[model samples]
Target: MPVVDIPGSKSITARALFLAAAADGVTTLRRPLRSDDTEGFAEGLAALGHRVGRTPDAWQVDGCPQGPPAREADVYCRDGATTARFLPTLAAAGHGTYRFDASPQMRRRPMLPLTRALRDLGVDLRHERAEGHHPLTVRAAGVEGGEVVLDAGQSSQYLTALLLLGPLTRKGLRIRVTDLVSVPYVEITIAMMRAFGVEVVRETVLGEDVFAVPPGGYRATSYAVEPDASTASYFFAAAAVTPGGEVTVPGLGEGALQGDLAFVDVLRRMGAEVSVRPDGTTVRGTGSLRGLTVNMRDISDTMPTLAAIAPFASGPVRIEDVANTRVKECDRLDACAENLRRLGADVRTGPDWIEIHPGASAAAGAEIKSYGDHRIVMSFAVAGLRVPGISFDDPGCVRKTFPGFHEAFAAVRAGLPG
Candidate 1:
């Protein structure tokens, strides 16, 4: 099988762009993801007058750790929520005001929480089209960051925006959070911000809804992105779905900074023989799939593959703690539930959860709709291998993360028994 390394996390890429734009002097990012989301971040940074140069190895981002975006930005964030969220705050910290536009898909995503929070923090930002969404105008103004509260359960990106930009604000932010989900992602942001010389201190919680970031700015340095553990779950899970073979993802060792790396434990729970190495991990199919109940608060992306493999299990596989799933590229819980039902699997969904009942093997090979979500396309495509000749429409949608997702699936599938 042809083995390839997926670029670093798109989440990391966005954070890196924000870091580069917010850092002093030049910063080099190694192995950044080069997808639409990251590209949009780069474009937005370029509009803000960061000399983000693309190289064969890594990107060289010339930057300044000071107030005001160096230039006028006519940014098209497209469907990248990170670009749509983080860039606005960075723009608010810049030299002059800029106009921010987005694609139709980007237009549909909510930016109100971040916007409202920014407005409360004294940002002179406005909505061009919808009040709470994209097509935003980032006016030149200083953010007087002090205390701000937001409903983070909708999406943790808002919290991330504040944390990343907290140091740049005049007062430095002390945030009070409510309904904050996807905390692992926030932890990643906190960890990465610390890596770049920013400080996010969490004091004793007054209640469950509060967090504190101490006053400090970010440091500039070279950084490398770990290979994507979330993408690796598919290949490892593929080994379990397709019997008689094992798949290994190298370079994803134990104790990764990315929270999505926890998917390895999920595969082990489902009866896959798992071995974790300092360099990577391997998963071999066990004799039978067992029932599982998992709360995927930290590792929601793994849900698609886990759910796809669920129908082969001995009983129901219940996935919980994924209210965050609803606000992803698409509604992953509904997508998994609805699509599995199409294949005659007993699937049920909730506002934020999913359950899959084991069932007979059926190769209907119907055209699966991706809804423009990459994980849905690949996870179901893996399930397609369980039934021969199953294919997907708009399979190219996987380029959002795992650019070679289809080819990688094919390479591994070609090695399996018929």
Candidate 2:
């Protein structure tokens, strides 16, 4: 068995940074992911005058319950949607003028839902160029939170941004969500809030979901981030595709918090042997892969992982109900289709789904065109395991989440039989 040590969760680290920054005292984060996206989030906090101490093993943050220490700031959010969306909301709780911008790719993503909700909450927000996009400004005088409606159909990060800003307001927040995708991500948010000393009330009234958050701010505590389940999907897929091969990843067992961890169940359904224990999880190849249709709305981040390995299955693989993936780093559905076709696999895409037929020969070497998206690169790398001469146009893009992905993946591949 190849024991792979995956990095910490990007979603968890980002949420922990937000909670720590809004807490009443100092907070320490153990085993946080050090990647481009997370580094940009920490830098955004520093730009707002929060004290963050960094070491190899941990990151300590000096929380500011009264909001950011700075009165004015210009923040660059890089390509991290969490940093771009969450940081401005954090700055809104303080007294100042904060201008936020991002890379061209990040600027093109959806921002209107969160900004509109903030504007409805009485914050003076302006879009520097396009409406509902980045390169915006927030004139902050603190928030007097109350009832507001949000549509998180496009991105759950919009809802998460508002949820993180709840306790920082004077009057708390009562959010009525009209529609939501990725319910598990929101669940992770609520659970982490409780860890930092806040209990969010959830209820359904008149067929709509509502979240009631109290006005008291967070209490700081030492937090340990779990290994990223999404990142672990690649290694698990590797094991599932390689006959007689096995892979184990520690720190993501039955009690793991990330929804992406559920990808193993999808693998198990495809004929791989899976084991989930208290300390870790393992996947072993049984030499047979049976394809079937799967709905991956809540865990859409791993869609590409499944798509990459679909060519090796004995039947057609159909993935459905992941429309939100279109607005991610790239149009993942289309990207997966393009890459799978490039590998000579028969692929088809719909508005929100993909189907891959297993007749095409995927063993031939091909160049994968990575659209500056990390997931695109990582997912296609799995195909390189069986297909010789696989090359990537932009392999370095994995730095957004896992800077050392190639080396780690190479190690796992070297341990497996050819």
CA lDDT, every prediction?
Answer: 0.79, 0.94
TM-score attained by model 1 = 0.95
The true-versus-predicted C-alpha distance at residue 375 of model 2, in Å, is: 0.6
lDDT tens digits, residues 370-409, model 2? 8899998999899887778889899999999999999999
User: Which regions of candidate 2 are displaced past 4 Å?
Assistant: 362-364
Cα lDDT of model 1 by residue, 277-377, tens digit: 88877777766778888999767878888888788888899999888777778888888887787777898888778889998455566667677888898
Query: Model 1 segments beyond 4 Å from truth?
Result: 1-4
Cα lDDT for residue 356, candidate 1: 92
Angstrom error at residue 392, model 1: 1.9
| Candidate 2: C-alpha lDDT | 0.94
